[model samples]
Target: MRIIKWVVRLLVLLAVIFVGGAFLLPKETSVARTVTMNAAPEVIFPYIANLRANQSWSPWLDRDPDIQLAFNDVPEGVGAAMSWQSEHPQVGSGNMIIIEAQDPRRLVTALDFGEMGTATAYFNLVAAEGGTAVTWGFTSDNGNNPMFRWMGLMMDGWVGPDYEQGLNNLKKLVEGA
Candidate 1:
């Protein structure tokens, strides 16, 4: 009976610690990956600005090759949108729409992952020494949700590799073109 009481107390203490720790976590999380491709921004911007063009380099497609993708009529620049559905959990259903486009410099998209919430994805192009530096990034507001706050801590590790692979695919596509 004494051991059972002690075990219950320990579990209660752990629950309190976890909840308190989650509140201390950041309210936002972001992940970004950059790659310098031996191509001008003008050359790379099209692939990013156009949802259809992105098909060649998007890593998620590789994860679920049979994933169904639907693109809006405006396939490039602002208002361009693409929604995808896949049975694969890693390539779950989501939609992304281009919200801002700065020609060959920057592009921003709003991404909706349904119950997983939404995030902002962006591409920034900068002229570098040998070519253009393309930075792909994602940012999510965890809000006041303790569960989301805890998950935010792992966002980078979860998303970074996919970004890296996507950038690498982009580099190969553009540089080889």
Candidate 2:
């Protein structure tokens, strides 16, 4: 009985630590990765800023090939939405809207990770030494979710690799374009 009581206490302590860590963790997360493409910003920006052309290069598409994808209120620019549904556990689900954009230059998005709420993501195209320098970044305001705030430590663990891989994939696709 004493051993069981001690085990229960330890488990309770762990849960409390996790919950408290969440609030103490940073409330925002951002991941940035850069890629250079042989194509000009005019050529590359439209592909990403347009969203319609994303599948051709998006790393997420490669992760879940059969994931159901659709577009609504689709236009070539801002206020456009792309929503995806997939059973793949790694991919989960989400919707992204091009909230603001400047053609052939910058694109910003509102990404909602479902239970996690919404966050801001942006893309920038700069004239690089060889081609266009493209940077992909995601910044999320975690709001008051103490649990999510604690997750900030793992934010890079969860998001950075994808950003890097996505940028690499984008580089390959655009350079070939």
Candidate 3:
């Protein structure tokens, strides 16, 4: 009976620690990755602005080759969108829609990650060193969910590598073209 009481106390203490830790975590997360491609922004824009071309450089697509994808009628620019369904947990399911764009300079997208909620992503293109420097970024707010807020703390470590690989792939494709 004494041992059972001590075990219950220990479990209560651990739960308190977890809840307190969640309160200390950030409520938002942002991650950005950049790469310079040896091609003009005009040369690279199609690859990003066009949903079909965009998939060619998506790192996640490589994660689940068998995943199904649905594309909108408009292929590029502000209205372009794509939804993907994947049985892989890491891949999950999501839809992305281009919401704002400035020709070859910038593109902003809205991403809906099913139960994980939504995020905003941006692609900024600028002329640099006779080529284009592209920055890919995503931002999300965890709202009032303590668990999600805690998870936000690890978002950079979780998503940064994928961003780096995607940018690298984009560079290779545009430069090779």
- The lDDT of model 1 is 0.95
Residue lDDT tens for model 3, 47-138: 88999997889988988889999999987999999999999887899999999989899999999998999999999999888688899999
Q: Could you give candidate 2's per-residue lDDT for residues 45-151 as a string of tens digits?
A: 87887777887777677778889888987676788998898888768789999988898889999998798677888999999999989998888887778766766
- Backbone collision count in every prediction? 0, 1, 0
Ranking by lDDT: 1, 3, 2
lDDT top scorer:
1
Give me the displacement of residue 175 in model 3, in angstroms. Answer: 0.6
Selected candidate, larger lDDT, 1 vs 2: 1
Reference-based lDDT, each prediction: 0.95, 0.83, 0.91
Root-mean-square deviation per candidate = 1.1, 1.9, 1.5
Per-candidate TM-scores read 0.96, 0.88, 0.93
Model 1 lDDT per residue over 12-36, tens place? 9999999999989999999999999
For candidate 1, the per-residue lDDT at 86 reads: 98
As for model 2, its CA RMSD to the true structure in angstroms is 1.9
Clashing pairs in 3: none
Which candidate order results from sorting by TM-score in descending order? 1, 3, 2
